[model samples]
Every structure is written in C-alpha cells, then in structure tokens.
Target: MLDWTTVLVIVLMAASTYATRVVGFVVLRDRTLSPRMQAIMQNVPGCVLISVIAPAFVSSRPADLLGLAVTLAAAMRLSLLPTVVIGVVATGLLRHFVG
Candidate 1:
C-alpha cells in the first residue's frame, strides 16, 4: 500500500536509529569521551525534551498555557509526582472555569 519513496524513507530512518545505538558501543568501546563531549552528551536529553514540547506550547490554548506554566514551575521547584499532579489539576480547573 505504500509508495517506494515512503518505504525508503522509513527504512532509512530505522537504519539511522539503529546505527546511532550501535555506533556508540562500537566507537566508544575502548575510549572515554573528552570533557566537552561529556558535557554535550549530558545536555542532549534536556534539549530533546524541549524540542518535543516547544511546538505544543506554541499552539496551546490559554488554559493549557496556564497549566504548562504551573507544570514548568513545579517541575523546576518540586519533583516529578507533584509536577504531574499540579499540571493535571491546574489544566482541569482552568478548563472548567475559563475554557
């Protein structure tokens, strides 16, 4: 049902993902990273998380924005459980009253 270009693109993506996972082990098997590389690696997860969430924040409703603000603040000051609970409760309440 899929065209060749779509299939090729999907295959390429899968192969690239697989290569990234395997290449780290192959390339770094015997050596350690430099300090700069280590710092860059440490930041990768946060950068990726922001990349995934940035688009949603741009497109969200006002109520959702309020919820996200509470969530971000809670996340920075509190812990995961409280952050998630605050996000959910804040969004629900805002949606009920303002939405």
Candidate 2:
C-alpha cells in the first residue's frame, strides 16, 4: 500500500539511523575511554530506561502502577533478565485482568 515516495522516505530514515549507530561505533573503535567516560557510558542505559519508564508509570492506572512498583522492586533485587520478565508479565497480566 505504500507509494514510491513513502517507501523512499522509510528507507532513507532507516539508513540514517543505521549510519548514526555505525558512526558511533566506528568513531569509538580506535579510542580508549577514561574511567570517568566509562562510568558515564555505564550510566547511560539506566538513565535512558528511567526516562522511558518513569512517564509510563506516572500516567498508568492504579493496577498498572502497582505492577510497575513490583517490577522496580524486583529489578532492584534481582538480575536484569528476570526483572524484565517479571515486569513484562506483571504488566500484561494486570492490564488484561483490570481492563
């Protein structure tokens, strides 16, 4: 159902995103980061995650908010994979039953 212009635009966007990611890797490949830089890099993922999840939790209903709380507690106490699984399953179950 896509026209040629739409397909071209989508392809260009995908290529642009891929190019930026590749540029970051390539630029960093030959350099060694300092301890401070490494710490910053380590914190990036968590910061990004909080940026994404915080708003969702704030806007969610009571049951969804409860699931988010449980998920956050599990994440703090457990490993990443288990935390993600618990969060996803809890959210899905709560939304399904509550809605």
Candidate 3:
C-alpha cells in the first residue's frame, strides 16, 4: 500500500543519514578534537534528545504529562532502563485508566 514517492523518500533519507556519518568519520579521521569540542560533542546526544522530547511535553495530554512526571522522578532515583520501564508502565496505566 505504500506509494512510490514515500518509498523513494525513505530510501533517500536512509542514504543521507548514512552519508552524514560516513562524512563525519572521513573528515575527522586524521584530526584530534579539542577538549571543548569533545565536551560539546558529548552533550549533543542529550541536547538532541531534549529538543525532540520537549515539543511532545508541550503538546501532551494529561496522561502523557503524568507519565513524563513519573519518568522524571524515577530518572532522578533510578538508572536508565528502570526509568524507561517505569515511564512506559505508568503511561500505559494512566492511559488505560484516565483516557
């Protein structure tokens, strides 16, 4: 049922993502990054994660907000896997009960 345009777009997107990573490795292969650059690179993933998730929070329903709050609380006290599990369970429960 997928259209040709959608398939082509998906293929191009995959290629572009692959090319980006390959280009990064090729361009940086012989160079040593500075400490400041390294620190910035280390934080990119977290910053990207926040940027992607922040919009969801702003537009979330009550159940989603409650789940996110529980997730945040769990994140403070637990590690990554537990926090994710807690978030998913809490969200599913809240959606079932509240929605």
Task: Give TM per candidate.
Answer: 0.51, 0.69, 0.61
lDDT of 1 by residue, 1-99 (tens): 779999999999999989997998798889889999899977776575556446649855888788778778887997556766787788789889878
Which regions of candidate 2 fall more than 4 Å away from where they truly are? 1-21
TM-score: the better of candidates 2 and 3: 2
| Candidate of highest lDDT | 2
lDDT of each: 0.78, 0.81, 0.80
TM-score of 1: 0.51
- Specify the poorest-scoring 10-residue window by lDDT in model 2: 51-60
Candidate 3: C-alpha RMSD to true structure equals 4.0
Model 3: lDDT to the true structure:
0.80
lDDT of 3 at 65: 86
How would you encode candidate 2's per-residue C-alpha lDDT over 16-86 as one tens digit per residue? 97998799889999999999999997877677567756865676487678778878999789876687788
Taking the tens digit of each residue's C-alpha lDDT, what string does model 3 give over 1-99? 979999999999999989988998899899999999889977776575456446548855888788778877887998666876787899889989987
Ranking of predictions according to TM-score:
2, 3, 1
Model 1 pairs whose backbones collide: none
